[model samples]
Target: MIAVPASAAGDGRPAEERGAAGRPSLWNIANVLTMMRLLLVPVFVLLMFADGGYDPAWRSLAWAAFAIAMITDLFDGELARRRDIVTDFGKIADPIADKAIMGAALLSLSLLGDLPWWVTVVILARELGITALRFWVLRHGVIPASRGGKLKTLTQGIAVGMYILVLTGPLATMRWWLMAAAVVLTVGTGLDYIRQAVVLRRAGLSAAEAERDRER
Candidate 1:
């Protein structure tokens, strides 16, 4: 049986690889956009909190920034696919940037009474729990981003954006639906990760048993 080489395998030198070698890696264009998303986080926060009697205007700017960030979330992956610039760094940084921005926005909204405290807590708990789990499982192997996981992220972005944008009356009902979608996706994806983790563990155990049998 042939084992996969850790590096590019020709030179045999692993040059401190951080992201996926695919187009989504740090070299990838998608990841550049992901970095842009991270860069915008501070600006968004500043726009959110620079309230010197222009609270509503600043809030509106914050919403627009959030909207742009969310749009990038969709396009970066598409751009990676189209341009074929995916990388490992893209995977790690993309998600981290996503969670930081969303988490900050949600927390701010909750503080301002735009969203329910429980909703913010639920969203944040899901984000942190998944991130910690990702690192824990990385020791065993890379967990390729699943389709369901991507869907969950899209839902999360939409939900958080809706919550932030619908601060006024009337359209607030739509925001509630978005939040419900996010919650459902979060729970579903969490379960999906648990199942994947179990499968990976079982696969490792089976491989070990096979190796032992060969030795015997």
Candidate 2:
């Protein structure tokens, strides 16, 4: 009888098989949902600007598209983690889609004079800066989304949806309040992520030093 390799006999499977088992497929339900969100961005913009952003019916349609896109964001991450279908593409593309949708909405509103340009500028600046920082430290480690980050996203979505509805009087005032909260959370979470990056960098340096010592 032919003898099995000792390593294979102990684990009953080759290393490649184990690695393949843990690797996620690129074309999964979660990634599909993410792609759907990205596709809806242009649709949202078209609907918003179809009637110069003044028509009530077009605004309603725009809001519907934006709401659906936000819902996809909520589910895509959950589905990826639960189904074990998380991939590098999903991690990178998911946040990009989120930023694109929000940026489009904010910029469109500012252009239409529905929202202040300052607000748009501040929020977009924070988002793009943090995105760049994430990639900068990618070699050292990843900064996962914190609880505050999720809350910021939720608040931003609610505030933008409210603005898209173009509410009047009391509801309009409420929208401003919601936006204020979102801005606070956005800035606060951004600072937290910067701190996390510093910690991760230090940890990576420590790991490298320990490895070098062991080698010596």
Candidate 3:
């Protein structure tokens, strides 16, 4: 009954399930880091708003915290992979953590008038949509992360970083360009994800139909 947010990384496990190891999977090291990342989202948001949205030091600190949290996004997944400890729970938790961070940051920025609501909506929607599509594909087996997807993530991460830093320094004008890049990548990767999702869905339907035919 865990009504987890759509943006949350959902390795498809409920809150209480364990993998083959008989350990509380929610406590798995990798997922624990992901949860920590999720928890940090509000701290960043709070700091952003508490400073009246313009305190340079607070802004810098917020961005630094954000960047550090983002690093965990990379490391946790890699560690899971390298250790062959990937679990369904990890799969779900990782993405949820990522989206929570992105959505929270984007919303905070938009709240302070640094970003427009329309733009934030597009970005947030794509993030959530692609994630849901990913799980749909996952049900069919591993659909490896695409190069374009990685690029999208990279650009968005850096773009958000720049926008935050812009608030801290005098590079305010570049905010528009950073926003533009995030938009472009969001659309591009969203399309790519949709394409893959379609292919998988069609393939799955065909397999299901074929199995039905076998008994006839």
Candidate 4:
């Protein structure tokens, strides 16, 4: 007979397993913030295209909506972690919200002829591809966020924000370089995530095989 660890609370499972099984409710504050971000996506899109897509006032309002979405993105995950209320709903919805708002901004700018179509395609492709990869390997394990990924997000946000605003002269030129950096970061981090995902999946498969052998 095996002795159950005290941390398992007499259930014979590990504490970590228990924690995963008893995830917090979906209605928590963290998930609410993520939902708010998703709802802002359409609002941002409408504002971006308002006044024939060039009125500075409408763009400013769009920028305000984008900024709020970004700010909430930063807080929701941290709030979930700190409060120990991380939920599956948040895990899935948070990234979707992040991508939706960013994608909407990029697509709107490209449609307005403010940004290059190729640039929008590249960024959106990377974002969507990485998101697909995450779900592909989700049963194995999560690919933890890297510093490069965070930098990519920051650079992309700033570049997009600059484009949303009506700028001229030297500032306009600078935004192009910032966007270039963002594109490079997007591709670089995306490839790194793919590598990590492959490795994680392999490890998870090996562990599963070993467990089956033990059971046999």
- lDDT for residue 178 in candidate 3, whole number 0-100: 70
Model 3 / residue 38 / CA error / Å: 1.3
Pairs of residues at least 3 apart in sequence or in different chains that clash in candidate 2: none
Which candidate, 3 or 4, has the higher lDDT? 4
Where does candidate 2 have its weakest 10-residue lDDT segment?
12-21
lDDT of each: 0.74, 0.88, 0.78, 0.90
- Candidate 3 shows a clash count of 9
Clashes of 1: 14
TM per prediction: 0.75, 0.85, 0.82, 0.85
lDDT of 2 by residue, 9-96 (tens): 6443224323343455677778888999999999999999996788889999999999999999999999878765678889989999
* Runs of candidate 1 exceeding 4 Å displacement: 1-28, 52-54, 139-147
Model 4 Cα lDDT, one tens digit per residue, 1-216: 897655454343223433544556666778889999999999999999987999999999999999999999999999888777777778889888999999999999999999999999999999999989988999999998999999999999999999999999999999999999999999999999999999999999999999999999
Stretches of candidate 4 exceeding 4 Å from the true structure: 1-25, 212-216
Return whichever of 1 and 2 wins on TM-score: 2
lDDT tens per residue, model 1, 146-170: 8878887787777777665535576
In candidate 1, position 73 carries an lDDT of 82
What is the Å distance of residue 169 in model 4 from its true position?
1.1
Ordered by lDDT, highest first, the candidates read 4, 2, 3, 1
